[model samples]
Target chain A: MSRLPPLVPGFVAAGLVVGIIGASLGALFVVGSGADGSILGDPYVRRIVVFTLWQAGLSAVLAVGLAIPVARALARRRFPGRTALLHLFGLPLVLPVIVAVFGIVLVFGGHGWINQALDRLSLGPLGSLYGLQGILLAHVFFNLPLAVRALLLALATVPGESWRLAAQLGMAPAQVFRFVEWPVLRQALPGIATLVFFLCFTSFAAVLTLGGGPAATVLEVAIYQALRLDFDLGRAGSLAIAQLAICGLVAAGLLGLGRSVAVTPELGRATARPDVRRGVGALGDGLAIAIAAALVALPLAALVARGLTGPLSTVLRDPAIWSAAGRSLAVGVSAAALALAVACGLAVATRELRLTYRVRHLATAPDMVAALPLATSVLALGAGLFALLHRVVAVFDVALILVAGINALFVLPYAMRLIAPRMLHVAEAYGPLCASLGISGWNRLRLVEWPSLRAPVGLALALGAALAAGDLGAVALFGTQDTATLPLLLYQRMASYRMEEAAVIALLLMAIAGALFIVLERGIGGREHP
Target chain B: MSTLDLQAVGFRYEDMTMTFTLRVPAGGITALIGPSGAGKTTLLNLIAGFERPVSGRVLIDGVDMAGRAPADRPVTMLFQEHNLFPHLTAADNVGLGIHPGLRLAAPERARVDEALDEIGLAGLGRRLPGQLSGGERQRVALARSLVRRRPILLLDEPFAALGPGLRRDMLALVDRLRRAQGLTVLMVSHDPGDARRIAERTAFVHSGHILAEGPTADVLGPGATPEVADYLGEHV
Candidate 1:
């Protein structure tokens, strides 16, 4: 059986990505006049860039800084539901962006639950839901759980032998962290922090909704504002270029994170982590878990609580809501299918590339290809696509397709995370067998590869779908009255002070997002084989 | 008589360099006995076409198999473990030897069944590799090699994981297969007793060089090289 050379898929993936991001930025450069000093000369653009960096920086620092204690607590403690707690912390991964933002709003809004509590306690109602605080709150809300889980994984990876040694030496808790924990965390922290930073920096839908006004704008919002509201294509192009430069720099910085901490393979031979239960440490860990749990759970509770208001029948009967939900389902399914195809191709191709090239750097190439697009804000992607397609077809007419394409690209890194490692493992284990047995090409895929990859491949598709279902970035730029997705419709309803409809739609979007995730992750995908 | 030859073959992995010039007479069994990390496995890999030698020819029956893929080589190898896909049943794994597609004709299927039954795994063809005992697993692997109908077989410690009694049985099976098929066999083992049991000739590989190659009794006889004498210890 013959197959194409391994580099073909990666090159195709890289090409499509370059064509999209490159054409977006290049066309902007071509069409727009030299607005070289736009970030400095234009006061509005200057404010937006500063705020974008300021919020992402603050969010990254807070997410990681706070996650350290929470993650350590989870790692060291063997409390009941510890596993469930870690899974809960991953909720934001499947929850759509708008649903998360809605949850945040319901908790932090002026008339929301937290403000009501403050008023009852005679602490002045904190109207923190509409500006810089709102943006940072949502960012932290989304990223803190992820940061904690990542850090916990980092903490657990500190070889069991090291823990036994620390215990045998009777090292104090602080000393244990300093000598043992800190080194592992230090290795993993940069990647997690930089990832969180890039995500917040490319903030779109959440920023679009919570930005309050021009006073708290980000570069992404500015691009959308220029293109959609002002119809200033030149200004939008300049802003898109500016955003890419800043994001590209951050993405490059992210590539430097310490990686692949070799798991000391001596298993069953090493003793279990020196069973720890000191009084002071136990008390402190309990406190950390309590605080983190409350911080993560309250907003989700608020989303459900705030949504049960307004006549339930009227809320469900709204035809626009049903239509928006239908559109979202279609878009999510289509994007997931598209993203899975792309992710599988790139992963398999990368496996081939690694085999043919036999270089360590090329092994990490697929990850970089997947991640580079992540740093390119979808708003900028939207602006570029709009410019290119506006030349041939009307921008609004192809809005759904454009949004699906962007969301697919946006969800790609996550899909690759599920796919690439397992693909490489399969290639390593079976490459010789395949070579020896004359199993190659489509037959190899059908007989050998598919049986192994089905689970992770299914998981990747599900995650892709969930992310697409909840996308607000591209939808906000191109969404029209005729073709508005649930997220866009939810945002529009919130903008018009139809809080009743907004709440209902918020719950609906969350349910849909959560349902797709559960169905695909649990129902479709089988247990991952080692 | 078919011959298996390695003509000045050389391979380098990391810091270790291995060179070989060897010949195996048709139907003779050569035991490659070495300490661990002595490149015995690497030599087998080269001959099986899993890896290419840096220099010279791997000539099987007067044909230089320089550019042949592993599947194209007239050799079959059984690794120490993982010789069969865990997902495939014993029959299916054996069927892969005859046709990798595992889409055997009715007669070919009967042949696979017969091979299994001959290996004393008649009713176990439906069992996955994981379900089989260590000795049974290697029997399945050996049976697969038998179905391949290759003239030369390279077995790298195929029964190393089996117990002493089971190891003897597996070696007997190899001997039976070799005599019946007139197969030229090269088997790597750390145990000198294994060479005494089945091999006609024994080759001692130590740190990238072959220390001795002769009839097993002569090589392990009193006049053996000091290094070989020292290594074989009591097992010889």
Candidate 2:
């Protein structure tokens, strides 16, 4: 009789709790109807659904479509600043949405430098930079890097051995994609598309700032107005339910697609020389690099220049700016810690449960957490929590809890997404060995799992922290005259037309977020000698 | 006493409904030679207590160990890829078998040193597994089993990656270890030469069933099934 490995009941219990929480939240959309026609009768609800779907679809298509050519160029060619360019793609993964939006606005807004230059050249100041176009443009800006990363990662997976084989077979560039690259890209497409679509659908800050009017409003924006502006509980509840249904369906589809697709290994080690060497191909490659660089670099450069020329020094002197910066730091640290805890719990749970039904259900928690913050506006969440608990709780106390909760919720998906792959890899490769060694419970985690996951875990933490620090969403709802975050303060300065002050704060925010990410990533990940 | 016994032991993979059964005598090296997809590794996993058989019993020293975990079952497995903990030193990898956690006291270090010396790795205890060559890693794995002193040692193509010279040296070491410790060895190999070199008994398995089992010489000799003969390359 072979001995059965001892099951850790704690991990199982944690899984059960996460499962219950996700199911109950999902059920809330089904059972309750407060104002928007008992979850089924609201015509306004239909519009919200269509708007959300449209924006997400358009954004994902544009981002990924543009990314393909850029990825191919990157994969083939060697250039100065290529490594820096690769790292640039990772910036948006950690960059705060609000900060990125602010950067976009500086370049594209009516009175912004782009329009100013156009006006000087007698181009008549190209039409209004608001509504559907603005939101779609911002979405593309935010997600283009993500799409590039996913596509490049896929392109990298094409083995050099396969490339050598293709060369030996005298395959052309078209033939290479037809056989070698197409299959990998096809395999990676669903995952990349799903991730981008989910990101766009849940987009809160971008929609709120860029959507020109009511006709262009997304579901998350409606949820916010229903709660914060009107204080209408029923309408807010209905919107929440509607948001849940749409996000749930999309998430389920994504999960199903993700399961069917097998993850391919990364392509052979990167080569310094260009893969393509022909006339038209060379021109196309050059154009792709030039466009990708301009698209990412222009706004970033404008923001930095604006900071140098504007009220950076005055903003630095303001105690409010310093306090808000401090608050942002605190929130970021707390959110990162909370996100890590939840991610670890989910990972351990997924490992312990053998039943497919239970595993699939728990797997959705991280996705939900990631997408929910984007789907349901931060203002709406703050309003919902306040309404639910305000009868017994102090407003200020609830405000801080809401801030931390939103930040944690917003960052949870990235942590889970980052950690899940690494954890699964470790489990697939090492679980049997650990089980055979009777290395169960915390001992197994500390000795076997932790060592392998150290790099990914550190990266996840850095990303979560940076996102939290840069977040401008919940701050609008919970931030008081006294408790503003750096982004909130920047917005306040911008609102008062203190353009100089806002510019400085923007630069400082980017610097802090970037610096923190670098320090943490290097400190933890550097421990691995190789 | 017989070191290991299997009573009607059977295993079936969940993905497919095929079943495999096997039994082996104690003390000598029992080689399970088979084509791919023949459930050779499954049989090894079952005996090492890494996987539980769907039905029947496994006994070590006449005691039923059906519910015993791998660590508690007096069995050790050496894998093909050498799953040495990369962070730990070579001696520490061997030391894990005896202490499980490599938490050795003063006297245990001497025992570890002696085990390392016995495996011809005497002074190389402090080097990490990454620093060791392929042959050295396998020797460390062998030393690990020695330190554990487990009656049953399961080898899953542990020598498949080594050069011919090192493979022979390791086989000689395995023979010496079996003689010195009376360890009951069950090894899975595709190479007929490996089976003939070390195993006393060989089992020819195909399609999840043991087609034949007997002394190594007989199994590889005349009148064997054409599949077995082809597998052994009798024409060569």
For candidate 1, what's the RMSD?
A: 20.9
Expressed as tens digits, the lDDT of each residue in B1-236 for candidate 1 is: 36888888899988988888788888889999878888898888788765679987899999999976666777878788766655568998788777644567999999999999988999999998889988888899888778878888888898888888889888888888888888999999878888988899998888877878999998877878888888878544
For model 2, how does the per-residue alpha-carbon lDDT over B82-195 read when each residue is reduced to its tens digit?
A: 356555689877776666434689888888889999989989999998899999988988887888777788888888898888888998899899888988888888788888
> Which 10-residue window of candidate 1 chain A scores lowest in summed lDDT?
A261-270
Pairs with steric clashes in candidate 1: none
TM-score of chain B of each: 0.96, 0.93
lDDT of 1 by residue, A314-400 (tens): 879989889989889888988888778778777876776688677777777777777767668888888888877788998898889
| DockQ of model 2, rounded to 2 decimals | 0.01
Q: Which ten residues in a row have the lowest lDDT in candidate 2 chain A?
A: A259-268
User: Which stretches of candidate 1 lie above 4 Å from their native place?
Assistant: A1-11, A34-39, A258-275, A357-368, B1-236
TM-score of chain A of 2: 0.85
> Whole-model lDDT, candidate 1?
0.80
C-alpha DockQ for predicted model 1: 0.01
State iRMS for model 2: 20.8
